[model samples]
Target: MKRSDGLKMKLVDTYTMERVVAGSASRYPKRIALRTYAEEGSELTYSELKRKSDAVSLYFLEQGFVKGDRIALIGESCPNWMLAYFGLTGIGLTAVPVLPEFSPKEILHILQDGGVKAVVVNARHVEKILPFIRKKPEFLIRLEDLFHIPMPISGELKDRNQFLNAPGRDITRRKVDAKARQLLSEHRPKEEDPASLIYTSGTTGMSKAVMLTHRNLVWNADISSDVYFKVKPGYKALSILPVSHVYEFTIGQVLALLCGCEIVYLGRPPAPSSLLPALKEVRPHIIMTVPLLIEKIYRSSVLPTLKANPKLQRYLRFGITRRFIFRIIGRKLIVTMGGRVRFFGIGGAPLDREVEAFLAEAKFPYALGYGLTETSPLISGGKPKNHTVGVIGKIVEHLEVRLEEKDPATGIGEIAVKGPSVMQGYWNNPALNEEAFTPDGFFKTGDLGFIDKKGRLAIKGRTKTMILGSGGENIYPELIEAVINNQDFVTESLVIPEGGALVALIKLDIEAFAEKMALSVNEAKSEAARYLNKLREEVNKELNVFSRLSKVHLQEDAFERTPTQKIKRFLYLRKKDESSDA
Candidate 1:
């Protein structure tokens, strides 16, 4: 397929991570493949990446680890994380990447459920795994230095620190010689072999391990980089989202590798203090993120700055003038984002309405993607030029997508898909596997959406979160929350059913509220209550009667969210009789 740059991407002989890395190495041996953002001398070329990954594979084999064994990777995004992932998956091991943000209990559940035999952990996250080290895993390799972390007292597991500490061939400095390469080649996984086992974030309180095969991941990365986005060889990609999530792993890391683009990892959270400087240093050509990041930027910086300008406020009242003003602001935004970004990909959750409008009118290179981990996370998306405000764009190439049980009036229904990228099934859960797919083989996405007249997909909300109104009408909390979130002083919101009526829980922008009211936090809290009640009345006028909130409550804390910034609805689904207060 011809990519956006008009270059033809040759079909891979085998759909596997090994093939992807090997191909890039052979094609661009001296090209920088991975590096830490703003850290000089930390770069790895394509050939170097391949050799290091090979060394990692041989190191695992030398430790008595074998293919098909689940190896857990717990860490922030970094070059070492990619090396460990490629090393394990290339040698036919199932890569079980645990989110570093997961609690100790949650991490334990994943390690136990996946039957992880080995763990490649970041030093910072080792405390979370220390208690469970005796339960299942027999090996611990520190990710920071790529050395064996010695554990004592139990003495039940082999101590491989000696091998890593060896003078001639240390773990980090080891070279995969011909003999080691030959041994590693013997374990090359087939296309259908499970490459990674990813656990869902559990917005509904039900987490399951999703088994994605080599073909599932490779094919998605192949088609996505080749047919959908415009990323060129030698282009720089700045990755911000957690690589543990399929949305970033497939599109950001793997696809960039497939395209021979240099990937710069933040190696830390992308906070303004660090990320702003990294942007200037990297000057990346591509960036992938979730909606929360951009939405926060819009709410905290761009929107406030624009609203505070009295001149732009009057200009923003007219459609043409608003777009023109946004265009100028977008140019500044591009410069702030390193002055060289070609594609700004957004997914993991729906983009807010106001943010999407600003991006669209400003002609920002912001793209929207929609899918679940079950599909290798890319069902529909497009370049910015083809994007509509609310729609997620056209279905991806070679995928069959249909709306199941469509509503004649609204045209919304469950999104069902069949494609090469669809997952094999949930790990060790046959019942869930059966229920996750249609009888004919399509994966039931469980997301409610409709294809617009332009053939673009517009997601409504999760079917699981849809509340049935008194008159049996479907009230989508996300849609209502989107509207509420667009209002001033509102940072985020959730709509839930209580006492047979809809209740709105809002998290206010404390600083903004304080500044606006010119009061201390304690005083602001009381004012916030009055403001929320007024906000609810105003927001209700824009919503349908059945969807209107019966009561507005101040949520003192931010709602507990999944990694994707989606609220864990199951946690707040129950009714509460407590009075509304900050």
Candidate 2:
């Protein structure tokens, strides 16, 4: 691959990327910095963003919040949420972002786990933990109270009453944004100083607070931008990803802000109808999505029509539709998506192959990435091609990646990364941190990947989650799920080991299968399950002896997913039979 035009960008150091974001804020302060889609399509622009963030920082200073204090911004997506985050970190304090979907117990655990001193939580979610607020009144503060507001207008104030009530409208609370900025001008944060304490979704165990510094976030974004798509100012972006996750924060919020993109934040998780309409309304050029979403879109929306007509799918395989029927289907999707989505970046989980092919046929720019919280969630990412099949992408500049075992093999092994984007290590868990990193400093990614001859990284599975066998062989559940999910009737599949044997808990597309069978909904499920069982048996025959499934559980409900759309694996660990061998 060679540069074609005069558009080559030098691989920037982490320091420069941070300077660029802050500097860009100053240079383009009045630009449409961010847009928060609220009730009935309400939005807030860049100037409003700057003003609110400034006021919040001032309020923090007024409240006597010291530097390094972890200010938890707990809420669903909103403009004020972003304001509080920037205000906290812009002044050298750590931002602890919590997803609003978290259980009250989980929220309390993280808020306490991070030792959050100040909380700027959404009012809507306040009552969920209202009972516990009195115990920590000093730290429990609502979002509306954080920004400097006018003295509680004593008269009839309806829309403003929400701000004037409990944990709100404290005009004298402390106007600190100006003071914090002044302090920032005097003593700024080094790249290494902890800036955010993001907790992993904890699908496996108690969520670990992954400490990321300014350097890590900024550097990782820079690499992702350069390698994936060099985002420019005013780049239209759709941000459906939750800001609490590392991928969404770095790529969706921080990166979008750094690039000066006007993100169309959907207040809710995007449904096809709502998403298509919003796409037409926003006309965004970029979209950050999880693999599961992309796969679903292709399977439920695109693949059915293709499979109905084998001749049409064959034509689609060539990137050209022969019949008018085929063209109509293709054009419908393109037009529905606003006909301008150039980069549909996918991550957070593995995509089903059939869905991937459908997207490719429809000419979707569905790039994939692979990484974990420790590396700021970006180890490799890029455009997909044949040689890059299932490979994340070329290693970003300044990242040194090597396989732990370098002998005759499938060219796959644990991926260890050495870079500034690597975390300073888990907070207050030196024992875990010591085990997480290599002796020479390369952080263990826990992913097994092989660098292809073309230099792209292809992931096998997590080191911890890889199933062990009686003969001491390793089997990846993801590999088994890949085959199970590829079957036409299957919608999603999870390979769970039960009683010393693998079992695939599968969700089926009942309606589609029912229609195909020309049967009613009730009859279709029974027919689909029988057919799916046969499909599973066929797939199982190809697996290694240890990786074989003893049974197949047909699930009508979808697997519980994290905010980022990853299946909650820990929830299924107990469902496995306890009689299995060690």
Candidate 3:
């Protein structure tokens, strides 16, 4: 890409990975495409990335893998992982990106369901697939350097590292023959071809592989560029979310490539110690993360400081002064986050109202987005400066979105969408495919929401999770939980229906409670139990009468969550006999 300082970028015709790679390589071959935040020599230029991916593609073709074959990609987010993904997709093979956090059983299920003929994985995740050797693929390639890892000696699983170190053939080592080079140069996949088969992290405790075509992925990335803030060549983007999630893959990776931006990946999880230093080092112009990350920062750091100061707490009662004070703190936060961030995209789950209010008042550049794995992940979003506090931005261009079976009183209903970015269907599941879309071909999002008068989308809750009140009113557990979560000393909360009444399972900030009260763990637990009723009363005051909590219990264990940090509601909706109530 040209410097993009004052030049206009010509749009590409095809919406395939091959076209994206070729265009970038031809325009900005020397531009740094990908790198690690902490590592020294882990950078790949656009030219190098294209060359490496092409070599992997040639190797697979030589191995007799034809078009439409499924290949599983399992590893942490790294350049090599992208290389393998691009290689597979560029050669017309479907790339199934699996999350590294999946259990052994989950990984095996995905491998079996995806019909993966081969697996490209790093050594870190090799153990997840070791138990199901009989049903797993025979061809294994190490993701670190694109070397083929042969099966273990005696066809038995011994050590994962032995398989990692004992490389049989290096894919890049073989010379490219004339015919192979010609074939690779001539090969082109159609825009409608399936580029990625993504298995969603189901919060409902069921998984399905969502097949996203080349057009779905690329077109979404292209349109999203117009939705978010503008970026020039060489702009830095720090990626913290799991790339296996469509939210990160399309917005963080593909969108950066389209803009000629350099993507920096964290070497480890984005904990404070590591992420703070990386923020200072990279000084990223863009960041993609889920709401939990920012909500933690606000709850742990920002909220306490404001409340602890007596004069500031008094001043916070006034609107004008409070916003000024928040802006000052927001400037400090910007400095803490490398002082150069322009677009901070938050998605995957609903952001807390308190945190969102603070962000808007503080002038923090935070954009809220709403989507799912089925719609190529971006149904509505906007630039931070253009974002409304309680609403996700307008639907992207070229998409038709409407509320289905909207309530006359509340105006909330299931969000149905139809667009080029929508996925083809659930892979190999005819029953689900039939139920997922309407007769007119609109994909039912399973979410309850409505379009505002200002043309923005506001999400209410999921259809399955909505509880019916005794008087036939709708009670959204998420809205009640949001109130509970914003309470003092509350870390997280879950609201469920028990015996026709809403009950809240609350997890307290034990360490904070212990520190403040100078109490031991047992004493803190007792103290928290005593405070639950008061906490329930406080939360109920912010909610409607029907949505009020009937009981509040101290949950000792943390609730299980999906990759996006959404509490798995199905896991907690237990039988009355199976209740672990405290």
The digit string of per-residue lDDT tens for model 3 on 163-243 reads: 666646778665657976798876657889999999988778889999999989888887777556877889999988888
- lDDT-superior candidate, 2 or 3: 3
Tens digits of per-residue lDDT for model 1, 149-250: 554432233233432342222465667778877898898889899999999886888889999999898888887775666678999999888899999999
* TM-score for each predicted model, relative to the true structure: 0.94, 0.87, 0.96
- After superposition, the stretches of candidate 3 with alpha carbons farther than 4 Å from their true spots are 1-10, 134-137, 151-157, 173-178, 575-577, 580-582
Winner by TM-score: 3
Worst 10 residues of 3 by lDDT: 1-10
Candidate 2 per-residue lDDT, tens place, 239-266, comes to: 8877778888787777677677887787
lDDT of 3: 0.86
| Candidate 2 stretches greater than 4 Å from native | 1-21, 38-51, 144-167, 170-184, 313-332, 384-387, 518-529, 541-546, 578-582
Q: What is the Cα-based TM-score of model 3?
A: 0.96
Order the candidates by TM-score, highest first: 3, 1, 2
Clash pairs of candidate 2?
57-177, 58-175, 58-176, 58-177, 62-174
